[model samples]
Target chain A: MTGTGSISDIEPRLGYSLRVNGRDHEVDGAWVGDSLLRVLRDRLGLSGSKNACEQGECGSCSVRLDGRLVCSCLVLAATAVGREITTIEGIAPEDGLTDVQDAMVTEGAVQCGFCTPGLVMAIHDLLDRNPAPTALETREAISGNLCRCTGYGRIFAAVDSTVASRRDAAS
Target chain B: MSVAIPETLEEALQVAAADPEVQVLAGGTDLMVEVNFGYRRPASVCALHRIAELHAQRQDDGEVVIGAMTTYHDMERGVIAAALPGLAQAGRTVGSPQIRNAGTVGGNLATASPAGDTLPVLMALDSTVVVASVAGRREVPISDFLVGPKRNALGPGELIVEVRVPHLRGPQEFLKVGARNAMVIAVCSLALVVDLERRRVACALGSVGPTVLRAFEAEERAAQEIDWQTGRLGDPAFAPEFGRLVAAAARPIDDHRSTAGYRRHAIGVLAERALRRSA
Candidate 1:
């Protein structure tokens, strides 16, 4: 347990029950050292959250833990037990997409699509916290999210469109 | 292999006392990186995020006591920023919103990285680290708490309970040189504090030595040369001299991030700029 290895080699198998996407799930045979990202993608079958960088540097695995955006790769699955988790799959309605997602689609912000879910979640969190953010604010909000494609021009456009639509809806 | 989520300080201490090998997890900003990179596999982890007492903050006497679990996000706003603006500024420059939301000052101190953004601010502010165990509690100055790079003075079973930073006497400033603006580690960082009450000025440098270092010679010269009322040195020549002394105080080494010569030069420029800003 004091050295790096597969989670199974670190500890005996265990079960961790967690709530994800407004549903209760009991994940069994989970490795004690498994990260929340691993459990979400492997055990729970939630592939909406990508695991590009297991490190916190890349925001590819961004998810909401108890309503706060966090890097899922950094959180231990055991520590997340009983906590509320909202992934990219949980953000939108069953049949439709979130406003941020919709704006991203309309703005052609998706190029490779690997980083889109994280950018979408990051923007959603930002707008949830700050409804009317300036362009600089939007850039700062998504600073952690790295988009290797589209040169971020389209991403900024997507954010701008989402803000405009939100204001229009409010009016 | 197991994570112990303690709801109380006493329980955490008790768990630590029972198992000295247990690693304390505050925000998991540093530890998780190590785990993710396959650098460490801790035998056991004591999760301290649920400890309410570790998240409490209070003003006692003339100082502010910030609990160990106070996140960088907390430092960027509210009373913590008002109490220690330099520290708050350093916190704002750490990583991004996601990292700041989960990174804690106590965790940064415990990691004891020579490049830690908050270390210089803690050194300049003359803050105190409060450690607790089942035995009792004790306070250690920030200078003594950090022993070396990635090392600290935490004893077995002892936990950093809180950090006590004295209320600001005057303006303070923190400046960092990095490869980029956001989500970058400091190549060389500096913090300057003006103490009008004591008529003294202090400076600290980071990422230039084995640990955060105080430019004592520069501090003495600045304190004696600067006009306390105006917060500026009478002669412009003193500024560069002070910067030279600050650079002389550092013992930087060449690494992938930067060269020793560049680090020394950056510290000098940062020192002068910090002085001008403080003035």
Candidate 2:
């Protein structure tokens, strides 16, 4: 047998209160088995997180589960319990797009746009951890993610410029 | 259905022991993939991730007792890397950061795959497996625990509790050949433990056999025949014999990823390198 059993055998009742997108929202009707990715997009109307590979490979459904970048698509909504989840929607404070988002657009880091949201979430996490990462570090940080467009040269530059701006602002 | 997440080690152990058909989950890097891909269907599952006591490391009586829940990251950090150098090197190669953060040596031993990254390291280190059940706990050498590929001596209700590796005699080395560097499973991987003071050597290979295997004959040949004085394997004859010994140990089969011939060749090469490194 591939696994010990199927997840279909162990569904729980869905009444957990999950704080998402900087707001406390009760996932009342969602099932115990609903993925955090689905809950964020469908219930919370935070559609920025995409579900390309729910298996944690694509990195498309990436989000910050309590500040740790995780595959939201792979995470069960029940696991959230009372953790704060930060999707792309929660990245900027009502001030429009954040500096990182602006850098991606200004530097033409946006490609076919399918991988953009995941890239955004990943880079935000990376910067949050290391505000000043080298080019190689930046490359290594996002190696978990796959980008089909824009050969990543401009994307790297975009992140680099954003970091430079953040450094200057800190100074 | 959602598997029950037991919060305590005793509760988790009791649940696992009580449920005859329950499959244990820790990290879920391997089993989860298999389940998601329609490989296995477990009915009742017990997750051991949250248990507090399982993630421990201690040194007692010159043997390093690594808790079953200890993550690969934990091994890479401190005394674990010093006590089990080959195992540490192997851990460094297992999957990516996320996978390493989640995977554990306990899970590695339980899976008992021929290609487990830590298996060769454990075998070379003469690691001991501590299996726990409702009856009691039993410790078995890795040699006896691994019956074949994807098989083990573990009985139902028994789970691997910890791996005890004796302190290394000297610095050890590990190397693997795979499709690429990051997140690649081994085509052939080997670990070497070099005992400089005692003039002894141990070598083990993964992915060339039905299970992770030891080159015991090769190790003996090095100790008895090879020249530790000159810092080299003295007998050219021993190299051929060692190759033969290692290749003979291979229970590898022809598959899409590799040919039997390539596996044999890789086994010999890794055996030679590991032996020489230990020397």
TM-score of each: 0.96, 0.83
Cα lDDT tens digits, model 2, A31-127, are: 5445678788888777888867556666777777656676676555655665688888888878699898899999999978877888888898789
Q: Candidate 1: TM-score?
A: 0.96
**Over the stretch B155-174, how does candidate 1's per-residue lDDT look in tens digits?**
99999999998887788999
Give chain A TM for each model in order: 0.93, 0.87
Candidate 1 residue B22 Cα shift, in angstroms, is: 1.1
| CAPRI level of candidate 1 | medium
User: Model 2 chain B — which ten-residue stretch has the worst lDDT?
Assistant: B35-44
Candidate 1 structure lDDT? 0.89
- Candidate with best lDDT: 1
Clashing pairs in 1: none
Tens digits of per-residue lDDT, candidate 1, A1-171, equal: 578887567566777689998898989987656788999999999998899878777798999988888889888877887779999999898799988999999999999999998889999999999999998888888988888988999999999999899899989
For model 1, the superposed segments whose C-alpha errors exceed 4 Å read A1-10
